[model samples]
Target: MGTALEDSEIYQKFARITDSLLSPEIEDFKDSGGKVVGFFCSTVPEELFTAAGMLPFRMRGTGSTSTELADTCFTPINCTFPRHCFNQALEYEFEFLDALIVINSCDHIRRIYDNWIDQLDEPEMIHVMSLPRKTGDRQVDWYREEIAELKGKLEEHFGIEITDDAISDAIKLHNDVRRLQRELYELRKVDRPPITGAEVLRVMVAGTALPKADYREMLQELIGTVRGLEGNGDHKARVLVTGSQLDDPEFIELIEGQGALVVTDATCFGTRLMWRRIDEDEPDPIRAMAQYYVHDRPSCPRMHGDQPRRLDFLKELVEEFKVDGVIGERMNFCDIWQVEHFMTGGDLKEEGISFTQVDREYILAGKGQLQTRVQAFVETMKGTD
Candidate 1:
């Protein structure tokens, strides 16, 4: 797999970005007077920032492997994902952020936003938007209004007007990126996938880090490059991964190293980021962005009354990817996935999908244990086959 992508500059660039919290390309963009907005979740409408001519960077706790500094501000009871984010902030890894946005996705993340805003001095502009837990007409309307309000704030702070034409163009650009991402995933459906899951996760994380235009072109080129190549061997078992924040591609590599190829996943940073597209035909781009993110985007456990919807999506992925088994991976202290995984266990069993749950810290340190469990699971999957 490594040799296959060695000559591909697009794959190499994205892989480099995944290794750091901030990339040289982004620094160059900001250096050229482009405003960069740092956002936490996909719930934040990135099209708005791109339309406003600012770079929308999805905040990842990459580059830093320890939470030592973050522990001073937060407790051990808090999930390591957010804590690691704080750790990076304290280390000045996110000093390039001109503005930051956070959504009310979970208790720990909400608290992370609060702490960042109250504790940090950088990120001159900080905003927190409440993500409604339910789905409906009223919620959609409210979310649109919230998006409008955010747009207004951005306009006022940046002294730039985000025109309708700009938003329309931004939507088109983002939609193209989604289309390319979907096409990339389609290549995985083959018996021997050309690209590995670890590489896919790195590309997905890079998609959130760099500008849309840059990522879109790279994805297009990479897709063309990979399709012309042959698949790497050792695709012993097709597996689907689901769970908490998977910001690290090394985690995916660990599973792939265990001989099970991860064909697809339901992680927040993985498939959920690019599976859906915004409707461009809708005259109101803002309303379209708000509606799609709230209703049509991949279901998160935080969204109440969507458990069945999430399971249905999981089942569809299993069948679509020809997955032989499912791995329910979660962080140790993540309450949301803890319960969601417990409930999903039976639902997957009823469908006869081989499911296993493994909990670890956000920054995985137990590669030996994880590899052992993954090996056992791969053997079990082969036995079933």
Candidate 2:
């Protein structure tokens, strides 16, 4: 799998999508007069956007390695992840975005949305929705209403109706993407998976950034190539990384370079995005998307009262992937995950899993310190082995 993917043109395209905000594929899509809707968090019901005859692009600060432009509008005290994305927008990097839909998943992101409206003139349309912090029957209903409202806004703004058939098709398309991603992860169930964690992260990012149909085809091709490959399994340990927004492949490479294989990650761009598929059987596809996004999706720290659910998912990944330890990292100034680290770390301890937590800026620095810690964790896992 590794050999085939390294040689595949599709894999190179996926890698390029990860390194750039708008890939040539997307640029061409926009140039053809396609509507592109940019979104920030997973909480947004993207299937709705897709069904609305618009392309949903996950906004990231991938190319903006520096926050110099963002710092002018937002102080250093804000979370760097959103700031970095804002910096990219300020530089007209995301000029192709026709509209933006933001969710209040965290304070930092919400503030960035506010600044985006106030300071930016591109993205002719923008909408902010409040994500319910709880997962319950009533919360699901509330989210369903929120999704309906978003659909209405898009319909009015674009003068297009998102009919049931369009939504049903979108649901199936997204589910197919999730199914292929899960199959890719299942390859890592082997002691030494054919692909590396950095590769997995890149594929996941590509799924979000590229056109769904195009990504789905590329993924199917990659999966078949991976299934026939064999891994040496010579790494010191198999690790699972959980964190606040880990879109950068370089950070995963840095950790893997420490003689550990990152088999699975529980971050937003990782398992959280791929774990669940929308309920196609539901009479109304809109309600199905709402249910899946609010209840069935992987729980983030922001989902209050879902710590147990989150832990169970992590434990499942640890057991399934043969993880030696878990890395809990939070973006610097991300208070939500910062508080979650203690709770999650304690639970992992009781379950007899080794856990380590670290804080990082949006773009990583202090590589020497990070490598030392990961190397120590690798040694610990190796000693136990």
Candidate 3:
């Protein structure tokens, strides 16, 4: 198979496994070693966790079906993605996560850290890190202190001290992946790009679970190869996706494959990460972190402290991206997206922008239905009336 075909086949296999067989396999893997499980959000580095010779898994949300575990602590307005995923951790789905490294990037997630410690009595399973504040160096020391503290926790958990070399290696792995992802993103920025939205998402999710260096190389090669193709595919409707934890890029794939250009994003799994950069020469790493956490476009309900600015941010993307429509994807049980969907779209619609809303499941069970809806929406937007 060609690289694209091979990669597609691999994803098809994993999706089937995710659908038909992988739960038990992942369960088995979880059981094989009582290894360390870490969660790094936005700015906090995940490199250290990987360097410790521990199986580091990024925290993902659970499925759409509701659970009482999350309700005990979080309000009804919290984003359902994290609630569902974290609830799974609290319930039966997370037998493998020895500990959760929670980054206090936004309000609700930070609050969740405390709930995990107190209500769940999960002192052993929770490591909280307060992200640095963007406008100042005052918080850098505090962030470094938190990093140091997390290192101590990992040491105690694994019964081994983390070495400086391990930290450097882990940072290199994650940083390399970031570099490649940036290149992959550039393909779409070009007039005619080869890779699909689904392909992009597949590579990104794999980055979380696979070895970063290899992942980066494969992505860089994929983009480099794809950019050369003079894609003659039809793409009349132009759209941008805005949502929470929409890492799969399936929305973009589904809509664009039919006849739409998914040109930009406001999704955490995409632009939110894509826009932020780590300043190598900053007095402390926390400075870069603080900027990412506080300054990235805010969409989650919990991050609404300074949210008046996000509306303008969305407008900037719409204008710059030349978007003809917007697709607001909400996690099925996500309280935050549910709210933001209405709020953001309301602002755009009033200005005569075309848009649609999709409530998605983690596994993308109802994608065919979503595809049909988007196609119809695109037709309407095109004035094919």
Best by lDDT: 1
**51-95: candidate 2 lDDT, tens digit per residue:** 877788988898777888888888889999989999988899988
Q: What global local distance difference test value does model 2 have?
A: 0.86
Rank the models by lDDT, top first: 1, 2, 3
Where model 1 places Cα greater than 4 Å from the true spot, the runs are: 1-3
Our tally of clashes for model 2 stands at: 1
Candidate 2 at residue 122, lDDT? 77
Model 3, residue 202: displacement in angstroms? 1.2
Q: Estimate the Cα RMSD of every predicted model relative to the unseen true structure.
A: 1.4, 1.6, 5.1
Error of 2 at 320 (Å): 1.0
Query: In model 3, what is the error at residue 229, expressed in angstroms?
Result: 4.2
TM-score (C-alpha, index-matched) for candidate 2: 0.97
Score each candidate by Cα lDDT: 0.87, 0.86, 0.62
For model 1 the TM-score comes to 0.97
Question: Is 2 or 3 the stronger prediction by TM-score?
Answer: 2
Better of 1 and 3 by TM-score: 1
Query: lDDT score, residue 255, model 1?
Result: 90
Task: List model 1 lDDT by residue over 1-114, tens digit each.
Answer: 364875688789988987887789998998899888998877899999999888898887887779998888788899888998889998888999999998888888888787
